[model samples]
Target: MDTIVYAIPVFMVMIVIEIVTTIIRKKDYYRLNDAINSLSAGMMSITSGIILKIVEVTIYTGIFSAVALMEFDSSELWVWLFAFVIYDFFYYWTHRMGHEVNILWAAHAVHHQSEEYNLTTALRQTSSRFILGWLFYIPMAIIGIPPLVFFTVGLINLLYQFWVHTRHIPKLGWYEHYFVTPSNHRVHHAKNRKYLDKNYGGVFIIWDRMFGTFQEEDEQYESIRYGTLKPLRSWNPVWANLHLYSDMWKDAKATKSWKEKLTLWFRKTGYRPADVAAPMKMPDIHGYQNYDPALSTSQQLYAGVQFFILLLGTTALMAVYHTTPTWFDALWIIVLGANLVMNGSILEKPEQAIKLECLRFSITASALAVTATLMPVASIFWLGLGSLAVLSLAYLRRYSSATEPTAAIES
Candidate 1:
């Protein structure tokens, strides 16, 4: 079983606690649209992982079988501890290179796109990181670490980092020296001049300290600005994953020399061929503003309800994905992805939100009806989906005229 699947409930509970804590303290840490968008990107990543993760594990197992130096005993506690520590060591380099390399950053940038540093920000992840991220773990396989051990430690490292993506946690004086605390991880997520590209450890900060990438969160600087240098101005999850890759492709095509075109992706982060590089102004961090678009109460409620349905669908898919037919998995992924895209559109485009919702409901209903005729789907499933569609359409239609014009905070 995937360890992350088991962590979902704990993640939800922590998010709820964080939300309540922020409310009690009167802190403006969470935004509805941004939080939902973060989760949408995360769900997209997990759903896509249903297939990609298999490829990753297969490749790792193949490499281990062919070239492992020696086999380690899986039952030994020492072996598990060693693998856990070594995983973090490689994670530091993998994460650092993710920022230093252009193509890698294209995928890694999704996690940093959110302006608010809350619990949901921790869930914000890239669907495409599997493209090259698995290469970093090849060392473990070569060292003869069992795949199960590697996978388990990798999950532990990942789960450890989640709690650090918050504002409520303060510096733990001595512990900060060794582990990746919220203070140091906060610097990792910040786009501020001094904090950019520092603290790349997954669970341990010693890697950053030893390698000279560590930057403490300074009180002298104004409140730390969170996000990438070029803000992801839209709420679209698919675009969030593709925008940087798209920019890189456009730059690759526009550059004059063939060599520059081919090498741009391998060059340092944010590199552009001089011939095609436009004169862009550096962002003023002092006046930084989040990318928040206005939504009416009805629209917000619609987005929330729709997102909850999508969340339940994603959870159900995750629980049974390994046992289900591949075709079913593929279709579920598609339906869930489309729903997420439409939900993002509803958040950003209020005038068209009702229309989009109606279209989605109609298409879904039609698809379910067609599937029911050809397959063994339960009548209860059809009944539930029909009820949801009717109630959702009626609710949206009732408040369709109240949605306001799209408004956003200017950067």
Candidate 2:
């Protein structure tokens, strides 16, 4: 059974509850563009996992078969508990280094790009984290923890983290002393000097306290600023994943010293060569504001509608990926990813967003036509394509005007 899959409904319910609770308390912690962008990054992460997970499984299985020192049975409860604790120990180092090291942060920074701290922000995962994340769990394979046990425990740890991302949850008294609570995890996400690089534990706060990375929530000081040191201003999910890596590449190219160019990836997190000048002024955290772009009511509604449709399609793809044909699965992922890229563009209100949306729908229409012709059931696919075509035409007619004012929505 897929543990993450089973937890999806629970996560959705908790998110709805958080939204309602925040509304009741009159705290506006969410923006439409920010929430949608966060969720889009999450959906893209899952889609990318469909392929990248094979590499992880292959590497771990190969290493275990070749070099495992002991056989740990998954059927034993004690063995499962041991594996759980050990996995989190390694996860701590992986996560901590992700902040301190330059190359690893390139992939892990996507999760910290959101300025709003909400339930949706928990899902803002990095699609490129698979590049190095699998390496952190190899100790389990080396000690002969069964792959099934490792997978299940890791899923449980991740599900435990979902509840701690919200601002609605306060300090949980003694529970905060033992486990990772919303208070400490909130400190983990903050960019302030006091809170920076603290709370690296995944399942237990004990690790952070033991390792000296712990910091209690200081309410008297500055309010938490949720984002990276450098703001990712745009809403593009693909760019969100690649921006830091691209920055590293640009810095490396601009440097005069060959040794500096090669060592930059392995250096400390914010290191820059003397020869290469800083690009811009450091962001002012005290007077910082969330990146909320102006969009017309029509554009906002259009993005919301399309985002809902694409999210449904993504959920279906994830649920049945095992049984789905390879080509159809690839096509579905590509279309959904393209849909999100254009959605981000629309939210950012760029001049080319409308054109991108039109092109995306045009390609989707063609894909549906091909799917209808090839698949045994054609009516459903044709009906979907027709509805999409009509929606695209209406959107172009309504919002493609040059004189349309950039109106913004608060929610």
Candidate 3:
């Protein structure tokens, strides 16, 4: 919990520094509103992730943490250095299998489905990673990497990954040959035909080179697409993670042959009926696209400024919450319920006027979370009603953009 408690303040400082640095460098490509919405989703998803971490860290790492029984500072400097590489080796296989197997990909695919890549994309991780994720860490226990060492090194490894998600950094040349620099990591995130399944290294590039999965960035294939060929195309992060599962389940049930059913489940991601293979013909994103998403100029400017202020407010809320107040509970109950409903809403109409609706959502959610900070809730149940109302409105308004179809890009 100290991690959560201190993290708010620390992440606040970091985000402020990042935002200000972006402005100073004239590199603010994020639409302000989308940034806030994505940040809110990321924070909530991180909260979800930590809940699962409690299971992995306490339950699974409990095995290694019990290594306190073995008398040694096995977590010492040289020991930890070795453990990091071993952990990376385990991670490499697990990550490789995730690309090959459909079930595993469903969980991992959530991270790559974002069309926009940046610091936020790094945060756009899978909530279900905890499911198969412990398998990768299990090797640490066998190797006698103590629970303390296992936990600490795990955090360090994960933190090292955060910097690797950026397009801001170019190739570190020879550094790419040793460690998993941003250049190598960018290739890992690519949806391009040739780049897929390459650069599977976590912290070290040697893992990929040794495994024969390494590929250098190609100047000829200058374009890189961030999202999967078929995007989730929804604002709801929860559904974003589950949509592939839902599609796969539907496909598995619909298929006539047992082989086809198995193929539907494990062959590849976004696999579906021949009639529903929209992803196979999806438009290719050519040229340099990063940080910037699909919003227009006016909406981009508006959303970006709103994101700046709301992020400040979110950080402040975290800083101030010494005691979980009635309104805080109320706000969460309402927002989380609405968030789930938003997930179902997207799967229902993957092509909808979400950009317009998101502006409204950010305004309302910010108002509620902010108001709750000041006013104690009369009833948490009432927040549930508010969530329901908002969800219903989302349903009614989803496809109201007839002037321009949601799928059509209007500049």
Compose the digit string of candidate 1's lDDT tens values, residues 1-411. 455677888998999999999999999898889999999999999999998888889989999999999999999999999999999999999999999999999999999999899989999999998899999989999999999999989888988889999999999999999999999999999988889899999999999999999999997887888999988988899999999999989998998899988999988888888899754556897786678888767678878887877786677678777765777677767777888898899788877866787777766666566456534432433654665686677776676655566677653
Looking at model 3, the pairs that clash are: 32-303, 32-304, 33-303
- Misplaced by over 4 Å in model 3 are 4-41, 62-75, 257-411
Per-structure clash totals for the candidates: 0, 0, 3
Candidate 1: regions farther than 4 A off: 278-281, 370-384
Against the true structure, what is each candidate's TM-score? 0.95, 0.93, 0.70
For candidate 2, lDDT tens digit of each residue in 46-150? 887887778888888888888999989888999989988988899899999999899899989999999999989999999987788898888889989888888
Best by lDDT: 1
Q: How close is candidate 3 to the true structure, as a TM-score?
A: 0.70
Candidate number of the best TM-score? 1
Candidate 2 residue-wise lDDT at 123: 93
The CA lDDT at 90 in model 1 is 98
What ranking emerges by lDDT with the best candidate at the front? 1, 2, 3
List per-candidate RMSD values in Å. 2.0, 2.4, 6.9
Local accuracy of candidate 3 as per-residue lDDT tens digits, 157-225: 877787777666788877988899878888888888788888887788898899899998875776666
* CA-lDDT, candidates in order: 0.86, 0.83, 0.62
